[model samples]
Target: MLIMANNFFKPVGSKIFIINFYTFSKIENLIVWVNRSRYKNLDKIKYPAKAVIIDFSKCKPNIKPYHITPLACIIHEYQSKGYVIKLKNIPNNIECYLSSFNFQQFTENGSMIDIPVSSDCKILPLWLIKRNTYNLYPNRAKEYFENNHFDGLSLWPLSISLAELMNNIFDHSDSPIPGYTFTQYNATQDSIITCVCDFGVGIPVKVNNYLQTNNRGKLTNTGALLKAFEMNFSTKSQPHNKGYGLDNIISNIKLLNSKALIISNNVVYRIFPDNIEYTSELTVNFPGSLFVIWLNVNNLSVKEEEFADEAPL
Candidate 1:
């Protein structure tokens, strides 16, 4: 079966493909076509299917992290859905790589993916955890820092980001820890990545609900996400509250020359170094939100400090 490139690259798709992933309707299973020579175009495979068919017949040279990360994420998505995945027309080089990777479903016995995560990427061990209160998260995430070997300076912004994320889950999401959080540092790439995923009310719904309660006009998912980065913008109504949480995350990214990708509903928003920005609305929607944070660790200049009082939230 031929999947047309034009089918995937709409206006929003050309800029940000993740938006298109959620918009694909009634996607019970996703069939992925990978052109090994054009590996960078994996973003075209935007939605999740009950089963994923990876036609890697064209791939000859083998794959790298850029390929691995998306492939792994897709594999994880499929496994989480208890779906069957098959890779066909693969070359010997790719097969050997998958063997060495110990990737499940590709092995001789069709086992599970067992790539040396600690080596390919620094990862958080806590894949799944529950949370009703805010206090437990940071403590539970201590393992993430310790295992990933993060420095105080690098940990600072992450600490604040996680807190606000937890608080958001508490205040608005009305959903606890039905989320997946991955924190990893790639030594060779000189970058640190933290991706947290949640299944909840999603950003658009939460934002519109608040607006409706306040008798304001309705805002689309794109507007709500754009507002999220604004300083003091919030949905919470509380005493002496200043919603600087999202703004704080944005600031730290600027201070450290980092990048951020925020996805909710059908919208995808990204902030890159030098203040580059990209936003797109999807046809489909992810229930809650996902935050992918990328920081240049070597360029970091934040001074390490001892917390005299407590955590940043």
Candidate 2:
């Protein structure tokens, strides 16, 4: 449970500890781990240091977009603060997943990990995208899935959604950190999941800020997040920024009877065919935005003209 480090000659020396969260690897688990009393009291490892090792060997292998986005974002936040985060005892599949995206390149003492030859699922490796490169997402994403033989109709909506979501990162996040995007297709389940994450001022913060600046009453974090999805709702004042991106994403996903999850700060807004759900019960400590969409490959089709002129690919 405890790993030791030595600088025996110095009066004050650094220590190293292995962090093992003895629970299912959920985003909330990572949140609680990282946010627990400077990250010391959570594991009760006693000695605190600038560097730490996270042991993911015992974690479940069923990692999802929702989990990976927050995990990567949290690590990015820590690294930005000069913390040395090291990964150890990673499950092979998880290691391959992280390695496929060049994830280790950004971590301390991390190296390139080879993916297994037996892997069958298709992956669009996680990308760190900035304003200059965001426009490439839609086209690149389209090519990736199209080349992989996904249905054209399904991809149209996905492409449009990606364009809007990617644009939102640079236009709205207002953070220097590049946004993260990833996609994975599970052939066995006939489903695809794509996610976008950014460590910028969250949607709620931006909405409340716009409200305050305009001399309007502020809404709760959850309320502000809901207001964000309303058609024509936006914090941007530009004439062409129509604020239809989130609304359009919801609309497209509904057409396919798919699902989308949006998280800003502590609030979670879920869009599904049956109903809309919003909650603050999840212990998400992220200060930016995370969006994820799930669609079944078999359930995708385009109603003629809905996405005709907007198909960039």
Candidate 3:
């Protein structure tokens, strides 16, 4: 039986859990802390506990989407497992921001109240894409990009990257839950941050499983992740599935001098324009996967003809 630590969370009687700000101040802490809270005092709390309160009163005034998206993802994950989630002391603006994401759809009853969309809003609202309705993402995303002044060439890579990540949830992650995504564009920097997250069997597990089933041996979590980036590396058995998706993402990032952060299993991989870095030393393993990519909007210059490359000599 795991005990609820004083720093990360506080168990309120037998039903409610209070998650303090320290637990989610950083991405790493959020990922690990939530996992810890998930299994704590399982026997003490009744099935479908009353609520889990996230105390955000101590947070700063300005909260970005990156800060909220992962929190929302974890909250949704908990909700799926029968926990009622509630917010405590959320700043008015933060509450409004959450409303713009239409987070009311995930919460039951009046846990989250909706606020009208602000006229000056710049964010492309968060989307919940189910496997059966995954096809809707690209069209909506394209419209978002276009409305934000993203050129056709820029749309090529951005759309493909977003679509590919979404596709992986169904074709690779094998998750039953719906996927979540949202984009934040920085007009001054001419950059965009897109987050795609899902509750699924992570990449490493899927990759190693495929390898072991074929008697090809298993890989370390880090090794499996590295293998996932290589061209033609796929868990799929079909010959037509060449696994070009991740490879295209890597190439597009490099070409645009962009960056990406991928967290799956117990590992986090950082992809930069010049190099990639990864770490497997996570305090708690992620149950699924999250991808956050930063794209330099002005740097997208790939024409249709530039997409094809000649075979290496």
Candidate 4:
């Protein structure tokens, strides 16, 4: 009986034993059914369960396969001891976890699919130009040219034209409300159209102010624009070379093969290489100026045909 009980309760390798069970002869077969019943209950009790604790301070950002020292240690210890350890509260660092373990098994089981860093698109705002401020107009124009990759020859004419136009804005207009704006639109396969505008007193109004004091008071906006074209007619009351800038602008427009429109004092003066004409109406609501230039950068006409070929083939 003692041998049977010892075989049943000794747990194979356990040192636990009852001291009084050593003596007895027929005890081996006695209560054998009860011993079997008790052995079945003992089989339900699990031994050597384990818990793994993880520390999170050594994690790095934007790297995968996180190194979990504690969990790895627990796994090693439990495997050696013939037991299993369950890890809890895995850190939110995904790259760390993925790199440390073959997370493909977990991911294949429909675990974590939404990655944090993956995104669709990003947006940014457009830059603006301020007017009436000296030095800024040229700086902004240079910036525009640089951003668009315009060559020195292509940039120079426009820069000169803008400088002259802005000079007029400051020199002639009374209470000049200075502001500038530019908008670009794709026109065709080889063409881009851009419009630049400013909210300030117009040229015709400034010319009319000069004319009004010079006994030419009844002159209209069209008359002012035409008179501005004249070599000697100027808005400056002082003895200075006033109309030179306008004349230079007209000459530069012809040289560059560009067109311009000057709207002021309820009139529009369209200036082109072939014709200089005007229309009268209060179309401009505020006290400002607008200059629109269209450059056909991709057009064969502007690129190849516009320039003279060197000698022969």
Which candidate has the top score in lDDT? 3
What is candidate 1's TM-score against the reference? 0.58
lDDT of 3 by residue, 1-313 (tens): 1233345554455456666644244556657554655434344435345567777776665665555555666666667666777767877876776666555554553223222122234576666666455666666666666665754554667778877787777778887566677777778878878888876889999999999998998999988887888887778734324546577778778878888888888888888766555465475677788888888887876445454477657
Q: List model 4 lDDT by residue over 1-313, tens digit each.
A: 4454545333434322111111112212212312332211223334222322222233334321111211222233333333333223345665343433343232222112221111111100111232324445444554454355443324445555556655565566543233332323233422223333443456677777777787777566677766776765567633334446666666655555555655454555566534454455553232344454443343212222345566667
Task: Order candidates by TM-score, high to low.
Answer: 3, 2, 1, 4
lDDT of each residue in 1-313, candidate 1, tens digit only: 2235344334432222221221122211112211221123344355333444555654545243333433444444444545556666667876665554345433222223222233232544223324433445554444455444654444566667766665665566644334545555667777767666655677778888888899998987798777767788788834423545577788888877888887776787889988788998765555567677887776655445657696667
Worst 10 residues of 3 by lDDT: 110-119
The alpha-carbon lDDT assigned to residue 244 of candidate 3 equals: 68
Ranking by lDDT: 3, 2, 1, 4
TM per prediction: 0.58, 0.75, 0.80, 0.43
Q: For candidate 3, what is the TM-score?
A: 0.80
Q: Which residue pairs clash in candidate 2?
A: none
- Top-TM-score structure, candidate number: 3
Error of 2 at 265 (Å): 1.7
- Using TM-score as the yardstick, the better of models 3 and 4 is 3
lDDT, candidates in the order shown: 0.55, 0.66, 0.68, 0.40
Give the count of colliding residue pairs in each prediction.
12, 0, 0, 12
